[model samples]
Target: TKEHLISVEQGKQYMPTDTTQNSLLNLDLLENSEFSSITRRQFISKWYSFSYWIIFAIIIISYLVYFILSKRSVNPIEIRRRKSTKIAIKRLKNARFCLKNRDFDQFFEEIEKSLWGYFADKFKINSSELSKETIDLYFDKRNIKTETKNNFVSLLNICEFARYSPSKDRNLQMERTLEEAKEIIIEVESDIKKK
Candidate 1:
């Protein structure tokens, strides 16, 4: 009987006469006794789920803060100024290529646009609303040299005349105007650097 009891307690075998031992075990369980609290698999599952949520929350919050700060710190004026300069340079290069190809129409248009864009960038003005008189005034207010100012004015005049008049010699005028514009750009850039 003792051997049977030992075998039953070890869970190797059970006998129908072990009713007293089974009742004792049931009473022990009813008293809130725990043989094992949490298994390794259950603990690992809970820890993984908790860490996953924490990492996800951190990533989302970080992106939200970045977006908020970037939105508030944007500078439209600086962006416009940079874009104007880039456009001017690209137009100037295109004008040079057109001049080389004897495309007088495109050359004149691009050169005029480039000049207007350059002035807009230099004076922080809107190119679309700019006029020759406004450009002259801006240069005058900035104390630009008389020679440089006159050269710029003459270049603009040639661009307008060549576009509107349409002469066979317009190609030569475009070449001369492009060179003049390049000189003005160099002088203006130097002036800016000096300031």
Candidate 2:
């Protein structure tokens, strides 16, 4: 190749210029060679293997996800209890909205709904069957903290009193009451879970 290049530089136009025999670089071409005879078998083997693994992994992950979700929600009663606080907090948010609008009556109504709905859902009891004594007995049976029960009673008393006699600090009182309502629901749920 060097000799051929030197001859070309010297204007030797008639000289044989076969450079492949002595060229410094090795050339690779796949056209019409052993490498280019690609069969569908090789391609399908790889493609099927990759697709099979991808499908297998998806199935396994889906099964695990389904198992976890189904196991968590298997028991309707347990699901109710676990979601009780979340549901109650949602109701209290509506109460908070009512409070923001200074709708004292609606605020109290929402508070009552939050508490009653929380207990009913948590204990799987009917709302109509929920009285002070019934709640006391439930708490006593579950051995919930006395202070928590007293706080619950205090929240009820505040709601009851506010409905009959109007208070001067109505907005502030309702805010405190809403917070207390949320706390009572959370406390009761935690106590039951603890047991």
Candidate 3:
């Protein structure tokens, strides 16, 4: 009876509005016109903005490698000792060659040079200031053996005399001097180890 009694205009007024359809239309509009999602390729193409950071990181890594390599890791004393030993051995070899060839002038010169050079490198002393007194004082302080000290001092004197004196027997003294030099180096090295 109620359905039959209602009029067309009154029924239209009583019906509720369709809110779901309106909300769906709004979502579609937003997706199409207001906001959009980017693809992976589009995001990756904007690499120019980050290129500076990549270059900076590479430079930092290179400098770190250089620093690590350039830093000295060996003990200073050991470095000095090794360098002195190498130079002395090389000079001794040269002196031996000179002796074999009967070149006494060069032989004495090489021996003297080697001794002075070793002292210079070992004590960080200047070549001009490397005097007998300086070496004696250094050896004295280190408490080197008396025989080693005497052999070192005497060898220097002999080398100097052979260099300056005119009438020296070059061939006769070569073998003994060479042997003494080798012995002195060995003994001094052992004394250094003891200290």
On TM-score, the candidate that comes out on top is 2
Query: What's the CA error at residue 21 for candidate 3, in Å?
Result: 40
Error of 2 at 191 (Å): 3.3
- For lDDT, candidate 2 versus 3, the one ahead is 2
Model 3, position 99: C-alpha lDDT score: 92
lDDT (0-100) at residue 104 of candidate 2?
90
Model 3 residue 128 CA deviation (Å) reads 1.8
Query: Which regions of candidate 2 deviate over 4 angstroms?
Result: 1-47, 70-78, 193-195
Q: Write the per-residue lDDT of candidate 2 for residues 6-69, one digit (tens) a residue.
A: 4334564667757885452333343434544465567778899999999999999999999999
* Per-residue lDDT value at 171 in model 2: 90
Model 3 lDDT on a 0 to 1 scale? 0.79
**Model 1 — which ten-residue stretch has the worst lDDT?**
1-10
TM-score of 1: 0.57
* Candidate RMSDs in order: 9.8, 9.8, 15.0
lDDT of 1 by residue, 113-173 (tens): 8888888876888757698788778887887877878888788888888888887776667
Provide TM-scores for the models. 0.57, 0.67, 0.59
Q: Using lDDT as the measure, which candidate wins? A: 2
Q: If ranked by TM-score, best first, what sequence of candidates would result?
A: 2, 3, 1
lDDT by residue for model 3 over 78-153, one digit each (tens)? Answer: 5665689688878989999999999888988888888877777776777888898987888888888877888898
